[model samples]
Target chain A: MSSVGAAEDPHHLAHGHTAAARDEGGIAPKRIVVSYGFWLFLVSDIIMFSAFFAAYAVLVQATAGGPAGRDLFKLKMVAIETALLLASSFTCGLAVIAASARDMDWTQRALGATGLLGAAFLGLEAYEFSGLIREGAGPQRSAFLSAFFALVGCHGLHVSAGVLWCGTMMAQIWTKGFRADILRRLLCFGLFWHALDIIWIGVFTIVYLMGARS
Target chain B: MTDTPPDGKRPWQNVWRSRIRTSLSYVDGLMRSVALATRRHDGVEDDAHGRAPGPAAALDAGGANDHAPGLDPVAHRASLIGYVTGLGLAALLTAISFWVALDRETFWQPGVAVGLCVLAAAQMGIHLVFFLHLTTGPDNVNNALAVAFGVLIIVLFGAGTLWIMSNLDTMMLPPVPR
Candidate 1:
């Protein structure tokens, strides 16, 4: 088998020039592909959310004449969730910028901030879910409750994954610095993070806000 | 023509023939109009020359002029206007959606509700086109393709699930139990 250096040597000039040109163009092909991968992942994620949306639509009135969304949903809490998630997305953007600039300190700080805000958003959601469950509206209580749990729980799970992923990336950045691989990973993470914000906008509109009023 | 198959037939031959015919007519009409315009512009000059000037010379001159940068203030203003107008439209739509969602009693009419859903979808599209810059450049092809695939899967799965679940509800839990 050829050594790594041997494999790179033949294509080194060509690849270097192309990579430099990409950088000069204000976007790296690696970064672009990484962003596309995130989008593909988000598409799969949207499939999951789509299932949740369908469930919610079918069970929107499955309250069994008990406590409906109007009774349970608090717009204020949801607003906070929105704020936290949006802020996390903003920080995730900043993290991407920092990574691009190779500013390790700012990248770490921005990613750390994103992780914290994501955690806060997840916490609020968990609180909301648990509070509803404590009030005799658990998932097992009714179909409406079940659908609600599944939908919101899925998003909460995504936020949890994002937080863990961000934390891991932050550790890698802190220890190894902003390597190309790490930057690619962070680019994917940024897309995933922002996609969540977009999904949350849908959830807020269809489930919480509309449900509350209906 | 010399590369015909042993069977003296090509499956794609029919398809190519039809497509080429359609494309040829389009190109012919376009070129004819271009020729007519050029003739009108060079009426006197064309008479002066015993024959039309060489196409190569005209092409070279045109290409040189094309390379010269021209003031594009209008395009710049148009892009700015597109951005600002897009954002305001999105915000306005969001506010209206919120208002409707909050006042559901009045907006719950079936037709109105569906309209609102359509409006929301439109607003999402506007956000994609304007703020996300999804189709702003050649490099964005991958981005657009990814988004399209994602949306297709999501819509298919979401709608399918809803349909199946609703059917199950009717079949399993009839209003009047058997």
Candidate 2:
């Protein structure tokens, strides 16, 4: 831990400088602080999701003999949704890279791709939910369904917001031309989109795969 | 340091003792140097920004960060290869998850659920590292610390719920034969 003092400044810390210790006042360049603060937001967001996850896990078996996950989950559809989200996450990361370079054209392209893929994912989800409701297995049917809807629906809501964010970022870049503030927003958007993919990993594994396995 | 050991000390024990003593002194020296460096850095932030303190002052020339993830974006500077690799690996993990769930016979029979969980964990880790770019680096200590705390909370919350709920479920009468 003492080795951290060797870093000449926090910026050098990025290069793996052997021992740059943050000063006592903890004064940092605004960017690092912002990056870290946004991460905290993302972490807090995940913690919120964990509560929903706990609820879902607890009530997963309380289906009251209504349609359980195995009867309703379609693995084929889920696989497609996962692919779409995973692809969007990847595109979002690339958009950040392009935004960092201030490459307006490619940045716009990547962000566009991210928004489109996310929209497609949400479309599939809406279809799935509607189909379930059509078959009388909606959230009102049982505790299990309710938990599933709440957890997965919350994530879908986040993705919807993220998609909207991506669109707005594109417009801002178009008008502002990769301004410093715009780029920062892009990075945050990247983090948010990636974080959503991570949550979906949990949802698919527990709610869809495990629920449908039997 | 304790003069000399009494009888029962073997030759290898003497060697081990020396190795430990040497490492401890090395660590001690490192700590001292770090302490000196920290003091040196105390009044240097402004100077580092204003003028070149030494030969390396030419750096830090660009990129004032915004209030939102700004510093990290400039510091880390997202790259093409990393995002591509992350995407490929994530896609592969998703494939394995679906494969394991949909078709169990071709793969190992037992523990399908366990395998799914393991795959999910691996995929989450890949996403965090590649897409999120959280690191154990000195600059990224805050990110690491924040995430560690968050994960601790999540594990405690989820695991506690499952444990308590399952126990309660077991204690309840079985369906009352209705």
Candidate 3:
């Protein structure tokens, strides 16, 4: 109604008016909007990881006459890594619980625990990589090693990022006093941390479990 | 008219003045248009931030003075239960996978492969439901949709790669004389 042109285009005006009406009625809360968007991003990330998984699956048998998974893998080390990662996921969930309750002390404690566990997992992984490299079974050794490092190493990078994010969230909550925005960020971090664990499960079963046997 | 600087000492004053005027007007016009576009869409006044009420804040505004907590405390407790269940299930699944892999000789190889895949899928579900809190409720439909789409893409990618690459391998690899 601001211009004669707007009046002339009744259909456009009507569409705009209806869209405004829908905004009033159908506007989602911020949590849903943010979480839904983040969920999509996580899904896209998983899709990218699937491409890597497919490559690894195809190349798993292609040791190129070099040492295979059974010759190189240490299941005990992998098992410990899995346990550490799983415990961290659980602690992350606890952090979410504490954050939701506005229990600052518990939230910090849980986040600290989660970070430590994540650090432990990364430490073990670094040790594994160093040992493997020491033994000359590094990524360049064979197609199998290449795929192995690509998949597991990518996961390690994510965990590293998650640890950093956890630390940042703790600092934010400490300084900001659990403001709503900070809480929202904490929720996002929790989702990210849990998604990493889900991906790790895939890595464990497919790469570690199946690879050793195959 | 003399084309001279207004200050009478600086030769570039007039030129600089014109340039500043042009830039200021440009910025003013930009601000006006942005204001117009953002003004009163759908009969509601847009806040300066132009953001809608988020779930937690909206609920807080609805007179639930105690809603400042991230979500319902009861729900948090319930989710704690979910976390425990998920952790136990995930741990059990990992143990089974390791057991199957380490034993190596008891089950048929292909059967073991199939079993591992199944266990992995189940563990992923536990994480999604328990850790991520993804559900099938109407409020969670979008999250569920995203997850389903991701699964579809992964299946297509993995299956397609295996099929095409395996076939190519058979054709390309030189046959060894037995």
Top-DockQ candidate index: 2
The TM-score values for the models, in the order shown, are: 0.64, 0.76, 0.74
Q: Using alpha carbons, what is the TM-score of model 1?
A: 0.64
* Residue A40, model 1: Cα distance from true site in angstroms: 1.9
Stronger candidate by DockQ (1 vs 2): 2
Model 3: lDDT equals: 0.77
Model 3's DockQ score: 0.22
Per-residue CA lDDT of candidate 1, range A163-185, in tens? 99999999988897766577667
Off by over 4 Å in 1: A1-28, B1-96, B103-133, B160-178
TM-score between candidate 2 chain A and the true chain A: 0.88
Candidate 2 lDDT tens digits, A1-214: 2234333445554454332212222355555677898999999999999999999988888899898888898988998998899888878876776665556777899899999999999999999999999999999999999999999999999999999999999999999886656666777888888999999999999999999976
lDDT string for model 3 (A116-154, tens) is 999999999999999999999899999989999999999
Instruction: Name model 2 segments beyond 4 Å from true.
Output: A1-26, B1-75, B174-178
TM-score of the second chain, cand. 2: 0.57
lDDT score of residue A119 within candidate 3: 96
Q: Native-contact fraction for each model?
A: 0.28, 0.62, 0.61
